[model samples]
Target: MRDPFAPDFFETPVAPEPPAPVEPVQPVPSFPHRPARSMAAAMLAAGLVVGSVAGGAVGAVLVSHRNTGTSPNAVATVAPGVGAPAASPGSFAAIYQQAKNGVVTINASTSSGGPRSFSQAEGSGIVVDTQGDILTNAHVISGANQIRVTFSDGRTTTGQVKGVDQSADLAVVKVSVSADQLHPLPLGNSDSLQVGDTALAIGSPFGLQGSFTAGIISGLNRGTTAPNGRALTGMIQTDAPINPGNSGGALLDGRGQLIGVNDSIQSPVEGNVGVGFAIPVNRAASLLPSLEKGVAIQHPWLGISGQTLTASTADQLGLSEKSGVLVVQVVPGGPSAKAGLRADGQASANDDVITAIDGHSITTIEELTQYLDTKNVGDRVTLSVTRNGQHISIGVTLGNFQAQPSATP
Candidate 1:
């Protein structure tokens, strides 16, 4: 399996003054290859880059900082959740008009090593409520000493990072402003979105504020890596021409309701190649309560890596299970190891095949991951496993996903 964290496989744009380089963390182990399909190959071809558009001098860099501390004094106002009405699809122009005001331009400045040197990063954000709670990508404000938010009405104000979840690449910024100065966008159900469904993206692309683009939801349940090298599953893939500075922007449906957050682009070059990935709004909405409270969100980690087993692959490998996840490696001292789950050894025999989790059948990595996403850290779950053709259930406790330093040039 090829390394997905290879230098050439991913790039992040940084600007103005470059910060001191940090040590690159080790890459996650590769999963077993499928017979005719390889996820790693596809990722390599479509290089992933953090889509925060940079101004001034551009350089290749990726910076990630994790802050899980709670702030008791911080307060945020979240928009009320409303279901999307059953209305006819609106035109892109109509959608833009409805959602443009809810989007804002974000500028974050990070201090360099020098006493007076600082670097600026620019991206877009969505106003979730009239009280000035804005949602953006975590990478946009990571390690920032100061933040500035520009509203659609040309109003600019100082912003504060209320909360950030780097594992999901999401953050919340708050500003002190009157309710009349804000326009909150309603959150839509991303699960209702389908292939060919209309997707309108509004953001500051290349510092172009209020830039709007139209495309269809090209794919669903796509998996990608976050800026911190954590796996982000159940992503919404689109060809909406999302560029740098579009990060943390809104991906709305035809009804002008927010469905996803523009996160990253898959392009060999720095520019968009019509392939962009967005974090599902449902996930973002789920995290809003905790994020708005200035409480860092911690994702549940299973602490194991594996590949989805198919009928063809099972027959080829002479395995017992036709469809399941083949446990290739389990991290020592991790939750799976603590639960006594067996991993494939050097002999590749006696490997444990995970068929289900808490009575939910999982046939693909995406299914397993999506199920896990709904769970909280420290939750106890039962894993249905098949080891040497014997079925058994193992109870395991989940743990928080630790952010690792990723290799970024």
Candidate 2:
């Protein structure tokens, strides 16, 4: 090591010459733009995977909220009125041009419980307002210590988390960017979205900036677990390719309106395999005011963990039909528990099976929760269930579902 205290150390050192300026490689949204996964260092991992035991467990990428916290709520779903009339998409270039600048890249540095240590994760976001507020998925910025939003023109700035609804997988992040830099995407009616409707996703997948993917609405009214295992109902399903870094990106309709926030992709390889999921923009729009005001969003809970019965599982139990969710466990003092609903205490063949709710047939946990979405807390619901081979109706007042820190991933 050189001795800095020496008298000769006072001499000035010559500065090195600056490198030549290189042309910036601008990412064109109209063309394919996906960066290899290796470039996106430390991408966050998603928890939920879709599959049966037979096909071998495949890992899809809808991340769970790692933070141990509480958020509870009425029916499982929350939204405003249905969307507007479907518009045709003959202008792909026009749609991309209109929304491109609004799309941004988010770099979140989160603490991993170690001192002076952090992990970097990337996700996509949209400018939701002129005040510098941006909308992104809750999990993308969850537990982040610092957030940076990079715009299409190569501008980056610090961000702050305004509010988060883990149950709904939605969040608002406010940045210090200039007002002129913000171009809020227009909110579209997700309820008006139909199967086969044109859908496009714009995000920074695999750290590739301004990447866009196109597809059609694959399904609707689908139920999936949120970051904390609370049910999210009426989700927009699409075949648009989404990857690890695509979380919090936009899912637009044919008319160039923001219809959903891309969140999950169902694939055996943790890559896009044609099936993906988004949080309906209508639901997100309905909660934006609350989120901007820094209020925690809530959803209804049933107080029980259920297993959607499958044909194989039903055959193992000798059931004539595998239609209903099997109650595995019920929260004590919960609404269901207070109403005398039973669970399969010992994995017995005679577990309490919910056959219907308010006369609506429920074959899967998704169906049961989807129906509850239309209901509210303190509402009385009649559940038709089979207990010990006997059909009976149980009236239970609904209770809010609480978030568990240890909700097993």
Best by TM-score: 2
Whole-model lDDT, candidate 2? 0.65
Candidate 1 local distance difference test against the native? 0.68
What are the clash counts of all predictions, listed in order?
Answer: 1, 6
Task: Tell me the spans in candidate 1 whose CA falls farther than 4 Å from its real position.
Answer: 1-90, 115-117, 311-318, 344-347, 404-409
TM-score attained by model 1: 0.73
Off by over 4 Å in 2: 1-90, 112-116, 310-312, 319-322, 345-347, 404-409
List the lowest-lDDT window of 10 residues for candidate 2.
Answer: 1-10
Taking the tens digit of each residue's C-alpha lDDT, what string does model 2 give over 120-141? Answer: 6667887776666677877677
Cα lDDT for residue 302, model 1? 75
lDDT (CA) per prediction: 0.68, 0.65
Error of 2 at 16 (Å): 49
